[model samples]
Target: MSEIKDIAKFHIFSSAYFASAVNKNQYVTDGRKEIAFIGRSNVGKSSLINSLCGRRKLAYVSREPGKTRTINYYAIQSRRTVDEVEQRQDWYLVDLPGYGFAKTSQENKDNWSAFIDEYMRKSPGLTMIGLLVDLRHPGLPIDKKAYDWLKTVAPDLLIIGTKGDKLSRNELHKNLAQLKKLFPTNHAPIAYSSLT
Candidate 1:
């Protein structure tokens, strides 16, 4: 298994206030390639984003499940030198709310479902969906459902197993094998240590 450091070249540029409960229409408009981060509640999705961007608090991390309730768009800009001119390419790091929480209100779940579905389906800049799973746990019912749902919607998908630091070498391999056997999908799952 190749290390995650070899594959993920991520940087955090800036966090945007596209929208909130106040104004849902104020979402990001800049045409940018986006890759969304998704997972079940308490799977460390925000922590993974923070680590990937080399920031400690770029995305909100919370103890409570389903802390994120909106579609967050982080602007990523890269410079390209062309003909003595500097060209900037825009991209986004999208964070979607975690799912499968039993305590969430019905209204909240319905709203988040609609928001996720709309964004995943309609966002023209969306490039891929990064599906996150806790390495310690096997796939749950909601995890399978989410994977299938994303596969149905997104053209590209990346499955990420979080909390690699907590597992031993053999444990990691065993857990990964279990995931492979259970999911049995085309998407490749990568191990990630957000604390690393």
Candidate 2:
């Protein structure tokens, strides 16, 4: 696959906080394709999003895990040239609540789980799901469960391995190989780091 080196060259404009939804009823349904980002707490989901949008603080970076409790929606508008014609595309980048390692009550975790499950199962505009995992330690039990769930519910699922900067080049490659072996799907995890 070909990669676009300069994101700005594509004339893409991204709004960090277009909307937020705490429940299924509040999800934006204006017919825009939605890409949801999900992962364990403190796996750098928010940081990865900010980096992707080419912004320093587009998504809130909290020191503590589970700081994001709602489904945050970011609108990205892009203008592309195809066949000598200019075309515009708008989509929503969704940040789902992270799971695990939150110093919250069991009740709150259960509620978040329900909310995430509902959104994943019922959202009509959800086109893709990015499942983030830490490269230092990938394929934990929770990550495996999340991958299995997405495989059943969503057709387009991408595994993202975050915190690549923390590992050496050799370690990164080894861990990536391990991750690929564990997931064992056509969708291989992409190595990513906010620092890079």
The TM-scores, one per candidate, come to: 0.82, 0.90
Which regions of candidate 1 deviate over 4 angstroms?
Answer: 1-24, 78-88, 184-187
- Residue 83 of model 1 has an lDDT of 77
- Estimate, for each residue in 54-145, the C-alpha lDDT of model 1 and write its tens digit: 77777889999977877777765545555787665557778888898779789978878888887778777777788888888866778888
Which residue pairs show collisions in model 1?
none
Prediction 2 global C-alpha lDDT = 0.83
Across 58-167, the per-residue lDDT of candidate 2 in tens digits comes to: 89999988899999999988777879998777778899999986589999998998898899888988877888989998869999988888788864777789998999
Candidate 1 least-lDDT 10 residues:
1-10
